[model samples]
Target: MTTFSRRKALALAGAVALATGLAAATPVLAQDCEKVDLTFTFWGSVNEKNDIENAVKNWNTNNPCIQVKPMHIPATGTNYVQKLTTMIASNTAPDIGYLGENQAFQWATEGKILDLSPYMGETPDQQYIKSTIYKAGDTLMGTGLATGVMLIYYNKDVFDAAGVPYPPAKADEAWTWQQFVDNAKLLTKDRSGKNATDPAFDPNAIDTFGVTLPSWWGGWYPYVMSNGGQFANEDGTALTLNSPEAVEALQGFQDLIYVDHVMPNPTQTSSLPTGDVLMQSRKVAMSMDGMWRVTDFAKLGINWGVGVLPKWKTAETVVLSVPKVIFSQTKHPKEAYEFYKYISDPAQVGLFKSGLWAPHEKAYFTEPDLLKTWVQAEGSAYPPEAMDAIVDYTLNHAPQQAPVYQLKNIGQIMSEAVEPNIQQIMNNKATAQDAMDKAVATAQPMMQGRW
Candidate 1:
């Protein structure tokens, strides 16, 4: 894996400047034209919203003829979807907005979203990471604003206290499943100072959990894939959640809580603080989460480190991002596309500086000069090993596109079948095999071929 150093990053400051200059060189409206107002709808935290508003202000200042109105929605998931659906129903949809992968494909198929292929100049594939570009067969539907991968976030202090070696930063050297569980057992301690490994350790009076086992599909799907299991077949025409590989992988996750007694269960986690706070307070030694958490961990001043997830059979991770699309109802297609392109560039949008996002373009990962622009910078929120744990792991170990990016009707399938069954397994109400068998049976009819 490629390793980055502070010296290399400092030396590449000139490359960062040149890249910024090129990105800012987009031609401003030279001739007088009627000003077009376009609304951009999206959801994010206060910081993210402020960044978008600032970017819009800059765009409006330069391109007077194409002023963009920023519409900030504070909600996400179902509420955001509901609001967006209502807007579309009322024919009041914004010119452009962020859409989840499932909805982007569904809307694009229904002709509710614009086909961006026409607006994209030749060689669009070369502009962004292929996985970040959302498409429906030959039609370009939308593109991810940024990309993120799943990985481990550990508190260095907790690891040192427990005398446990830190998880591997390099993907190739990732710990096996058993090793991760064993370390977690060592790290987990009770109020009486007994670790989980001790015979007298009290699970009910735990002081610190070893890790967090996320119930969400995004958290566990990679492990399933690592075990050569998949939720569905490649084309998404069949359900395969009940396969032996998937069942075994899921059972292993459940064992971390019920058998290994390291990670906290759902009821225990509900009363606990968020992941960053848990790590900072020494309530949890480690967390499995998306790379976006780097921003939160950095702000808390915790001595944290990034690491590749423990592997079952192969080192694998999921990469995902919200799709940014132009609404078909927009009257000003040209202006909307222009604004979309502007925000999609990391140089124009300042979110990258906070480590909340990774660039969607491939050059950012492959080109040493461009890689330094995001991965290694002065005062960067990213940890020292971010290049190997995140950048290199993402480029080499992660799937080209996660199932969420390609699976048809994935949202509905998860909501209706997969999530509920997985929840049952987490709650210990059902065995992994039985729960997954039910999931397959329930989701089989809902399956639609992949895009």
Candidate 2:
């Protein structure tokens, strides 16, 4: 095993491209099993890979029927699908794999994955929420083994030093958009120690940003939803990003960085850690990011707190969970079904939860003593109360938009139209309306052609 020092880890993290080379060799057999070896392909950072491996190792011990190996693919972002498609076509694809939830329904439509309904029906344990397991068409996919919630994460040390009250924990108790803006203004300060309100507060000399929202798809989705616009139509038949509400939402996101001057420009944010504005620790007072940020923060040993995202008129945010899927092409269908069933068992799911993946098990949140035991044993990195708050928010308030599947070339369109214009808006190159108008004009026809 390679030992990573603090300096080395930071350097590695800083220099690391999200892209990783696919490991050609499978892991050595840890223990013998009756079933054939199965490889699992996934895309994430080294830390994420380890967490997944830890979960798989636990599953491996008692189930002498199968030995599972993990393949850590390079972080090409959305390019992962393309890579997996190539591997699948080449017949070298792993028996079990990971896919974007948005893409899963589409893939299922093409018969790319094994229908897990039979296996799920046989399981007596209520390991998953029925709501979470359904696909875009409300077809039962597989058990949504783990989920990610879009949330507001704050630096406790920064809030403490700045003397601002930390954001609230419960989703229902979250601030309104204006109140959130006001709090951010209080926390944002210039090099001369003037807050955002002071006339002498130099935007150029601003030492701490009120927030750092990235141009990435995940970062921008909340803004779109905040204005009651979703990326796709309800049935996933068409793109709706050019809707009036979407225009308003995109404009607001632009104003935060451009007009307010309280956020970093696109170049600054892109060059920042992992192209993640929220991962900058003390540099940003408040930022919206995925729940997995907690797992990343644990590595830095920073005291961070999770909070509900401020509400629009409708109080909504992203709640997506990617699951391990069995490919339709697997040779050993019976054994494959058995393995999927095994992973979905509550005990196996609890192992995954211990690795910081959100539990789809409603019991983790509903039962008091069980919830307490979960925090003590598996959730030491986060407050159990905060996790519960997030879970509740997802259950009650989570929006059900089709995952960016309306546009065939979503990743490209985002880079070309969305990111550039959002960048221009942040740099004060254009007004929210003008930037959005141009983005809509460019993306509308482009997306139409693809669809």
Against the true structure, whose TM-score is highest? 1
Candidate that would win on lDDT:
1
Clashing pairs in 2: 19-75, 20-74, 20-75
The TM-scores of all predictions, comma-separated, are 0.91, 0.78
Q: Candidate 1 residues 374-438, lDDT tens each?
A: 66755567888998998888778876567777788988898888999999989999999999999
lDDT of 2 by residue, 1-451 (tens): 0112322432454211111110111222234544577877877767777877776776566555566787788757668788888988998767887776546666776777777665555432244433345443333456554566777777787788878887777766778777777778778888888878787889888778888765666677776787688776554344566678876776667767766667778767766665133534567887777776566665666676778777666677676666568887888766555555555433334433443566555554555433443344455556555654466776666655335533455555566777777667667787656776677667665463222
List, in order, the clash count of every candidate structure: 0, 3
Weakest 10 consecutive residues of candidate 1 by summed lDDT: 14-23
RMSD of 2: 9.9
CA lDDT, every prediction?
0.81, 0.62
Clash list (residue pairs), candidate 1: none
TM-score of 2: 0.78
